[model samples]
Target: MSIDSIDAAPPATAQTEQAVREQALVEEVIRSFASGGSDRDREVMNSLVRHLHAFIRDIRLTEDEWSKAIGFLTRAGHITTDTRQEFVLLSDVLGASMQTIAVNNEAVGDATEATVFGPFFVENAPQIDIGGDIAGGAAGEPCWVEGTVRDTDGNPLPGARIEVWEADEDGFYDVQCSDGRTAARAHLFADKDGRYSFWGLTPTPYPIPYDGPVGQMLEHYGRSPIRASHLHFMVSAPQKRTLVTHIFVDGCKYLDRDSVFGVKESLIKEFAAQPAGTPTPDGRDLGGREWTRARFDIVLPPAGPSTATATKTS
Candidate 1:
């Protein structure tokens, strides 16, 4: 063969050159967002581009896979409604929601740990006073919950707003009911001493809304969609950080395998079971039915910028 013809052959470095070209494309996309936007927006987009490209490259993603992902996201968007948030469920099942919470809520002093804010929180929940019933006729074994809202320094945060919600024993939130029945959720305020009490329901394990795109993803990954038994709480005071968390049932079987990856050991509390005819804390009649009670004292961290402080265990 002629020397010129031999020298024109492709070199063994062709694959490496191809990778460089691919990475150049990634950089080009990132630079498109680098200008003309706010600093934070640019930062987020650049990071997202870099990480997303790395993921695709790492998996050597195929065109079929990319198409399937696009379809999955489109279906998620289609299924979302005012009452149902499929995208939040997607983030929850992937542990993204909990990771974001961990980044924003630093462990300061004895402050309560935060967890995933599930897809069921609603605005303008009915207001109840301390020692009032919040179940709102939800069906379940009655549970009496009492707690004191205090700062990390142990100062009572009286008048703190406490919002609580949970699934009924049948494993459905009020918003999920077909008849638009409002139950199993309410809001109340702390008393003068930062103490609050309300009658709710003993939480039960429930699968997140399945039969959706998120559910199909979980099924494909061989993951369960059932979350641990718990009651959701969002507590806030004037000068304190708003805390979104859950007090899990200590003995729940799903605690270790919570679908949303939201179970924190410090957030688990024992729900003391009471027999029939037991004296209630507020002297309410249960009519010869068994009940349970739980106490969850919440300590709020101060409102401030996000920190990376190590979490303190209770």
Candidate 2:
């Protein structure tokens, strides 16, 4: 028989029978989890369903409110594209993304602590040779950044792929502006001795974009939309694990006043300006202007395979 004929014969139920049948359907849905899903997945989904239902009932949400919420979500989606992610911005503002990163980065012993990778990262930054200048042809003051990647035991880890990117002096990522140029960002494979060095502009504090709803929320609370100057790093190796973090520039105007509250005391590093003619590493003209320098270290823990779903970095 056709499926239409089967559908026509399905409603032979009184109110009591309907209720019982609904309960059976619910049980059947719950039991379906046991058929193929992992125990952990099944448990989590069941708990999520329960709490989600409970929340809906507890709020007694009206249809108008529901419609408004849906509209807000649609707007959020509309604001996101390849370079910008409104959902991640929402998660950042709500602090859920950072919380989840913290939960997943719990490390024992002396492993380097993990932090949320901000939403502005771009993959495949122009790969440069070791000791190459990343801050190409920019107007900001120059800085020499040198760092070593090592395990918790302090052994240099070779062959680590160190990916580095950062905002310009104006507090904008390369992708943020339409200049079609990317300075202060590059990818470099580590040397045999696990040391890495690059030249970039001295990081200056910058303001977060305040043109969107997140900005409105910040304004509603009388908050400043500023984040401290920092250099973003994502270091990974074939045998070892990966770390996504930033080296906060010390003495930044917004260090103590980050709008997103992303700074940690330990991550902050001094970027001291050296006297002129301080012997350039490249033996080039140092001019009369002072240069800045910093040394940072990255520590990686055991490797964890990437999850199927995208996990928001803070």
Candidate 3:
């Protein structure tokens, strides 16, 4: 029989009657959110209810599973702190952060691709010179990174601001410092020629804070928590889009399976090995140990009238 005929004869049995009642209950719950405070709030709440209800129905989810999910969220919140953000970590592991970035920051021309703005970024990094060091007493092999910023039309952007931060050789950011001292982070400005360089540590593969509830979720699915070796950059120039991105260490073991799925082929850069005793760009002697060099160029798109100052830097 056709769906129209099938629906016409539906609520005769007790089971059918109960099913109809349940369907009406779900609809009423969804509709109740229509009067939320603002249009955006109403839209968000209404859509959330619809999708959530549909999911609950599709899975025929048990009350036990629902309670477990709530408990997981509670634990995530409990573990969150000024130093740690379990929620962002959870979103990153689930690919939702990357997906949201892809949706909102669609690539324009040769503009640099953005990854997660990760929860680690701190405003007001100490400013340094164009070729100064950001290691700040952190322990690791020195790496030289130089890059240029330009517009989509290839015009150089002088005085662009660049902020950089990364983990030490052991894979912990400055904010995660056990001694409560900042390290491996700084800000600098581009030169008149649109070039900026700095001394940083060659990034090493590190595991995310896997001692939390998010980690438990990953463990439940048998997923590794290792992120690829990389350096983070937040570049901004006047009249250009602010670009938040990273350059992955070429040949890093986790490149193929970054825990947060942040790796992009174009963002991978080779950290060239330099022999010991080589002279550095800023005229410093390399001394005994071999050093590494990586260069990443950023291209930003016009920010239009909405974007404000890009005046801060390294």
Candidate number of the best TM-score: 1
Candidate ranking (lDDT, best to worst): 1, 3, 2
What candidate 2 gets wrong by more than 4 Å, as runs, is: 1-41, 57-63, 304-314
- TM-score per candidate, in order? 0.92, 0.80, 0.89
Best to worst by TM-score, what's the order?
1, 3, 2
Enumerate residue pairs that collide in model 1.
none
User: What's every prediction's RMSD, in angstroms?
Assistant: 7.4, 8.4, 5.1
lDDT of 2 at 304: 63
| lDDT preference between candidates 2 and 3, better one | 3
lDDT of 3 at 91: 85
- Name every residue pair that clashes in candidate 2: 116-314
Which segments of model 3 are wrong by more than 4 Å? 1-19, 304-314
Is candidate 1 or 3 superior in TM-score? 1
lDDT of each: 0.86, 0.72, 0.82
Residue-wise C-alpha lDDT for candidate 1, range 139-210, written one tens digit per residue: 999999998999999999989999999999999899888898889889999988999999999999999988
Instruction: For residues 1-314, write the lDDT of model 3, one tens digit per residue.
Output: 43233223333333766657656776698678766689988776766665666556555678999999999999999998887888889889999878766765667887888876777788898999988999999989999999898999999899999999999999888888667787899999999989999999999999989998989988999999999998988898877778778899999989998988999998999999888888787887766888899999999889854332322111
Our tally of clashes for model 2 stands at 1
Per-model tally of clashing residue pairs: 0, 1, 5
